[model samples]
Target: MKHCGKGVFLRPMSCDIKGVENLSVGDGTLIPKGCTFYCTRAELRIGKKVIFGPKPTIITGDHRIDIVGKHIIDVTDAEKLPDQDAPVVIEDGCWIGANVTILKGVTIGKGSVIAAGAVVTRSCDPYSIIGGIPAKLIKMRFTPEQIKEHEKILNER
Candidate 1:
């Protein structure tokens, strides 16, 4: 937890944040134990009041495999390989369950809930409840009217 906002709670041994310069955790975020954040050569922006369960892994970069008859590690030239580095954004008030893996270029919208052991590879809508290996949208947390009402209440504060 190199860069974090106010009142952010990070339990001991909870996070292994690579590339501390590229990571930004917002206010009131709670990161429990065994969480890993890999932000090598990419940016990870987590918004306010996000809650992360145990052992969650957020990866912001991957090795590109485009060469034939050559081991991926053998290819030393970075320019020859495909670009796998991308930013990962989690909007305000998301709850990421235990052992969840969020891949690169994913933006989780506000108030979304990611189920345990889910592998998230894409963006989610606001207030979505997503689950499963590929992390499909199970349902919205609230109806449109309810969301509007909640937003109104938040704005009043």
Candidate 2:
């Protein structure tokens, strides 16, 4: 891990992380068992107070499949395949549900809840309740009035 703030906890023995130095976790984030961060080409920033359900996967890159006349696994410098790499940012207070797959360059906004088995392919807004493969906005988690109150409470904490 590149940086970890207060109260960050992960079951490292049960997790499969490729780029440990590219993983930075903020205060009070609780990452559960069997989670994966495959960030060999880019970094991951998990914000404060985020919670993860079982077996979530965050990837910052994908294998190059466009190499002419060459298989993906046979690409030269396979570890540093730089063509499709980008950083992933999960903002503060997100609740990532079980079996979620968040792809590279996606920024999950503050206080969002990602539903179980969702595959997030794009960025989402704050307080969103997102679900489904190539996840879409199911709803906002709170009324605008309530969200203001929520932020106030979070700031106090």
TM-score: model 1 vs. ground truth: 0.90
Query: Model 2, 1-157: lDDT tens per residue?
Result: 7999999998899999889999999999999999988986689999999999999999998777777888778875554566578899999999999999999889999999999999999999999999998899999999999999999997897
Clashes (candidate 1): 0
Clashing pairs in 1: none
**Candidate 1 lowest-lDDT run of ten:** 74-83
Name the top lDDT candidate.
Answer: 2
In candidate 1, stretches whose alpha carbon ends up further than 4 angstroms from where it belongs are 1-3, 11-14, 80-82
Task: Rate residue 20 of model 1 by lDDT.
Answer: 78
TM-score of each: 0.90, 0.93
Residue-pair clashes, model 2? 0
| Residue pairs clashing, model 2 | none
lDDT of 1: 0.88
lDDT per residue as tens, model 1, 1-157: 4468999987745567778789899999998878888886789999999998889999988875777887878766454433578899999999999999999999999999999999999999999999998989999999999999998998898
lDDT of the candidates, in the order given: 0.88, 0.92
